[model samples]
Target: NATAKAELGRATWKLLHTMASRYPVIPTQDERAAMKQWIFLLSRLYPCGECAEHFQQMLKEHPPQTSSRAALSDWSCSVHNIVNARLGKKEFDCRTLSDVYKCGC
Candidate 1:
């Protein structure tokens, strides 16, 4: 139902953002390609059909920034803000991203 979809979206975004927060500072070419591929695969495999469609379109428009950890994290926050705006949700404060998303893993 709607609650399940919303929960899925929350979990997905948390995972993505946390991954970005932990990404290599200066990723290797292969690492960069892997992150890009992972995002595309996620868009295709996401459970919610409508959300997946919107995510694919956003990916097409913004693409992923895998050059560095900071770049990837910033890109993630920006894209998430876009989605939040679309959903009438409050935008996250990107300045505190690093503090907010420590994986401790």
Candidate 2:
């Protein structure tokens, strides 16, 4: 179960980061609104109950930074580091995000 949960988290973070990487550089207001709603829905619909609750709280504290691809990617890394810290995992360098999550699309 622990393995499955960890794998799920890894996969979810990958998806989120890749999406952030591909997000518009200067998103329209409608795009920004959509991204925000999508993130909120993610917190609400995440498969893991405890993880979802923690994500919801994090959202309240930090909210989504959808102003640009860079902003969203940086915000994603920061929140991911928050979770990593809580799990006693090493923090990822935010500067390496482009290298790490290359969607190529």
Candidate 3:
């Protein structure tokens, strides 16, 4: 169960970060609001209850940055780093995110 939870978390984070990477550089108000709402919904609906609670708290403490694709991507990386730190995982170099998460979508 724990291994399945971990795998789900990894897949979710990858999907989120890749989406951020492909977001519009200059998003419309509707687009920005939709993105924020999507994250909120994801946090609420995450499969793991404890992880969902933690992510909701993180959202309150460090809200999503949806001004631009780059900003959102950076925000995603920073939040992932927070989760990684809590799990005793090695911190990723956020500066390399532009090169790291391009999905070519």
lDDT of each: 0.95, 0.96, 0.94
Candidate 1 residue lDDT tens string, 1-105: 999998998899899999999999999999999999999999999999999999999999999999999999999999999999999999899999988898988
Clashing pairs in 1: none
Query: Over all chains combined, what TM-score does candidate 1 have?
Result: 0.97
Candidate 2 lDDT (Cα, 0 to 1): 0.96
Residue 31 CA error for candidate 1 (Å)?
0.3
The candidate 3 region of ten consecutive residues with least summed lDDT is 96-105
RMSD of each: 0.6, 0.6, 0.8
Q: Which 10 successive residues of model 2 have the least lDDT summed?
A: 96-105
Model 3, range 1-105, lDDT digits (tens) per residue?
Answer: 899999999899999999998999999999999999999999999989999999999999999999999889999999999999999999999889878787976
RMSD of 3: 0.8
lDDT of 2 at 56: 100
After TM-score superposition, what is the CA distance of residue 46 in candidate 3 from its true location, in Å? 0.4
Candidate 1: 10-residue stretch with minimal lDDT: 96-105
Model 2, runs deviating above 4 Å: none
What is candidate 3's TM-score against the reference? 0.96
- Best-to-worst ranking by TM-score: 2, 1, 3
